[model samples]
Target: MTTQKNTDLPLQGERYISREFFAREWENVWAKTWLIMGRADEIPEAGDFFVEDIGPESILIVRQADTGIRAFYNVCQHRGNRLAVVPDGSMDTFTCSYHGWKWGLDGACLEAQDAEDFTPNPCGHAQLEELRCDVFAGFVWINMDPECASLKTFLGPIWDEWAAYPMEQMTRVQAISVRMPCNWKTVQDNFHETYHVATAHPLGLNSVEDDYRLTAITLYEGGHALGVTQGSIPARRKFGDNPSLGEQIRMELQTWDLNPDDFQGREYETRIALQARKRQLGPERGFSHYNKMSDAQLTDTFHYTVFPNFATSINSDGMLYLRALPHPTDPELCVFDCWFYAAGAENAYTRLLTENGDASRLAGPAPREWRNYGEGTLGVILDGDAVVMADQQRALHSRGYKGSRLAHQERRVQQYHDMIDRYMEGYRPR
Candidate 1:
């Protein structure tokens, strides 16, 4: 059966640069969806907690004494003071720094200073308000909507396809959270389509089969979608015969332990060859997970976008997790998080080479480093995307600008907006 193409959902310029549009999203979209905040194993022990700021709300996700994860609004019950200012730490109980009202890990209000000052005691009855929290794919997920669907339900088919990869045991070796001067949707839209690679990521053609026929796009039951593209081989391009590009492809094959000389004229066959080589040598190299993966999983890239903000690209070698967060106030600004996870890096001797040839032993729940948008390195294609994003944000204000004329391959972008529109119209998961 053929997948139906999405209708062109008009994406207005105001939606990207207007304050009123952002406010609607805060209420209709951000407040109602399950968000993947961090890894569950990050707080393996009791009392270990981390704070995730979503729009104007700050949520405290903590490991309880019973070893289950819980989430609470990061606000003092009394007088609206903030709690847990630090990003992450371990503590027996959270005592409000403002007035010393203390709360246990389970969100029970244990103590309140000046206890006898009130007519009726508030300590025993009062507790920090709890939000729905759950764990899946090794990540701690939380929903502000108390009646929201379970994490597994929210994730739909994504939950099962993702299970093929050993996400639970992977290590986050590289992370960078940067503030960008573009609407959050810009980042999400960029990740949903491969058409841009022909121009935006020229070198990418040397590695991935970017042709539409070779790529399959699936729009799932929920707003979630995935674009699976056959990769680890050179795509047919005008530069296919370029000598320099051929050498680069050959070097990559050699690195994967596949001999470049074996497929000299037929470089496109390297992907299947590498997969066979990986299947033969993977187990000994500590790739315990590859044994469970399919042949496509061993060679191609399966990139998934989880509704409102999160996007992840999974493969046998590594996973790239990206999230676009709305800036608390500005429609023209958002925070973009980039995290790289390597599979089977627990074996110290086996090194995972990152996007820029930075081979390092990968392991984590690693700490994330913050950088200004134009500051530190974000690899090659991503850095280029960052520069264009700000300019894209600026161009959105042009009077001549019309709604996006999307290609069939870019149906996910239109569907994404269609999903957002559904949320705005009061559609919430039951």
Candidate 2:
């Protein structure tokens, strides 16, 4: 729970938009740090595989016959052709369409064409390059650097903080990926703080307090950070008029089997009452995980920023996971993923929140949805952030642009870049 504000660090536009900087990130930051691929539930069976592309690197994560998860470079050893062309599917062995080089799910060379024609047989001796892979909280994580620290050590306290929630069992009801025309850090910086919530997302004011003083920004080792604010309460600051708050509260109350009218004049009590009510009746409602959550977690939003690209806004019932990944070659373009996971899929409380949203849909066994930036599939709040990022990207190329002037609340943003600098300057395998 350490909190410190360091606003003195300057963030330059070059770090956001320069091609050279993007290359540096691939070499130092993304390459050396652990990254979340996706939920392991997506590939529960043997031979189930998924491909995650970050910058120029494409990784194949697959479930082995022994039920273990293994990750390897998607490149073929024959001619460097990509082994797995599709995003995800079930595959017993990866056969390169080019030279017919066959590779096992364990990334070992299984067979090859014209073995006698070569100076030396490449079978069994040549294996697919494998990266360090591990699983935590139901997500499959991969580190390009083989010497990278363990995922638990890399996650630090954030791992312990999220251990209570049933993240491993949570169902990913909705997953949407959008291509935004901005540096990935633009969206990453935005999620690190709530300073723009008052103006960018006024409706959020109803449920989230926008005052910076009340927001506890906690930074951890490995460049991770957490932004905590009072949730389930009305905004401390007025933002003209937002009529949706009542309906939202009413919907939540109805879902929890509480009468909305009972808290007509005492809307502030809704959060506390819901916490106590859930604590009492949670097991019967299929939320057995509620027993593991703290009272604050039952009603508060714990927003966690996992180093470079991943961020999660977690609560008792569900989580809104956001990730911004860099493009392979274009520094000005990036992909944004908006995913929703529910703590208890069969329960009314989790279903009520995840069932009706443009950004996310009802949790079931389904593949993720992918769309372009302006497709409007990301919902309002994320769509708004995308629009802001586009304009910010365009402005960064202007000659007058110098660096970002950050406020104290944006100290996490500063800390984020400072961490990036450390990575860029630290040990990188040659």
Candidate 3:
């Protein structure tokens, strides 16, 4: 999966701060593309549902009686009142708080006020307006456009490449939402390149090789991109006399009964050793999913950018899912979600690498948390990003600032903006 480099693509700063471009993106990109709303496993039983707000539209994803998932506009048929005001819960029927209209789990109009007053009764025939909804990789996805391509078709090679991982079986360990003070694209642009990691997240260099020359980057059709990083290895930038293994990598080796001292001078070989050890002992420890993954999938980190607004960092033990959503009307404001999942036997313990540090916790569904940008910490690295994003948004408005001057390593960022232009020009996925 490769694309021709278009060096002429313009990444003007105006796109980040202009209201006009923001409106165009909503109509041409957000409305037409398939979006991840929530996890399917979150709503396991009948009548369980979750509400997701994308821009100004509110979507209701519910698990139906027949064990299928369905999605509908959160608006009521009578007065246009939002049927489900809360984020999530289980309810046999959605009753409108304003007009007392009731809708069944299958979207049928179960009851309506003044049924006999109207010439034709709306109670039995009227139904809630529905959107196209489907489940992929354990996620509930919805599209506003009725004629959009199927999720499987839009995903292309990513669908097949990710099939080996037991993503559906993994348990979500952390869920967080933050109100950011920058354009949604700012977040996407940051993840499209690792050039900033060396400066903004220097701590990560201890275990991750941040050199672009060594990173394997692949560009796919429809703006999807992937960056594979070598794990358990120190960056070449570090200088020392037999620099020891990173604290995280040393702990990982100790977990599998391997001594870090054995790999003293051959730090790069730790990844392969870890993979071999995990393969030999995984099934016995209940990580049967390891048998399905490849050698690269076992020890390396694959960071995948899913087109317009989603990115996920997949590892052998867990995954980190991130999303950037446009604000309702402000081009400079957006919502960012960070979620972490761990794969193992139910009730098993796993160590998750976070900005705070490596923390051990039982793997399972965790509660969702919401906060403003400065209210709490998204950990060290993300907190640093959050601070810089606001400054970048403000700097883009400077008259002296020209369009982006990208390096070869930042081609993914250019590719992303180019795809946005294609969509604005009415390029639809087949």
Candidate 4:
């Protein structure tokens, strides 16, 4: 499939606030599309598993003794009781707390109480309902629809391009989920375009090129989009003497023993210099993953949006994985998850930027944490985005708000919503 022209589907505000629209999405979009569960490395050992709650369903993904991963609906077949209640754990078999029905790691029913009493014994025949599961770019993906396309097919060209990064070798250093008072799409639309960066995240302009004209935006087939921008440089038109070398860039240059002052009038050259330095010193510094990446990959920010509800900003040595998940019932509420991964020596101290452009240091793998909006920071930039989402959710309800008047740079947003319409109209990818 090739990338299509801009879609003319109306982006009415009702889609963001209507219960009917949200219900349609659950049935037509969320239930059919491939979704990211978590990283494969999270469950390395046999029997290790994690539970991801998406929409109204709970999916249990486990690493089998055979070194393959499998996913199943976290429900007991006998009485429809949830099999795995907690987030994750390791066990020889999944024993249903309600009926003591034992299911093996492969999802086959091992034992059902008084099974012989029934017409046919469930032990040998019964099985947990399974979902299509696949691993790509180190992420465990699950699809609810039995007829859904393969993950590679659904991802299109993104599959091959992402192979250059050793994401599987990276370790997740930070995981945070926040409950937001807004529709899930509200969060997605925000990331689809950088047009709001100048106003919503002014501080980010110091380190990123936010000009839509300068950024390379590619809208791909299957609703995936990519935005590439020069990093470590100010977005301003003029590069005057003593150009701003934001704290992050200053610290980065210092790490390479490059004097920040020397790049005063030549700030635009910093990114190229930094890329060369990293390429030269990466392997010795234990960042061998850099060798597989191109110079642009070493310095530019490659922001990708996977159809439906996932976005990631990938840097040379780190990445910010973001997801906007729908609430179980409310059309006006959603869950936002932010995870940061870094490629370096195991347990090595590394500093990476969060989705909100804040530099965060990690010693090793970090545990997932939950927070409500306003309870704490999602990072300075993200906190601002959260506020905008909430406000947009409210504004979308007003009579004055007719529909979205999108800019050329926001074409990704248009394509995303158009894809949603296609799904709602029963269009499935072959």
- Better TM-score candidate (2, 4): 4
Model 4 weakest lDDT span, ten residues long? 346-355
lDDT of each: 0.81, 0.81, 0.84, 0.84
Rank order (by TM-score, best first): 3, 4, 1, 2
* Preferred candidate (TM-score higher): 2 or 3: 3
Task: Tell me the tens digit of each residue's lDDT in model 3 across 65-152.
Answer: 9999999999998879999999999999999999899999999999888888865788888889999999998889899999999998
Ranking of all candidate structures by their lDDT, best first: 4, 3, 1, 2
Give candidate 2 regions above 4 Å deviation: 1-7, 239-245, 346-363, 427-430
Model 3: lDDT to the true structure: 0.84
Give the Cα error of residue 6 in candidate 3, in Å. Answer: 9.1
TM-score of 1: 0.93
lDDT of 2: 0.81
What are the TM-scores, per candidate, against the unseen true structure? 0.93, 0.93, 0.94, 0.94
Task: Please write out the lDDT profile of model 2 over residues 1-430, one tens digit for every residue.
Answer: 1012223645667777788888888898998998998888889999999998888889999999999999999999988998999998998899999999999988888888888787678886888999999999989999988888788888889878888888887888778888888899988988988988888877777776778888888988778899887777677585334323455657666777899778766766777887888888887877888899888888778899999899999988778889999999888899898887876455444554454543334445446778887875466677677788888888988779766788889888888887887787783322
Q: Measured by TM-score, how close is model 3 to the native structure?
A: 0.94
Candidate that scores best on lDDT: 4
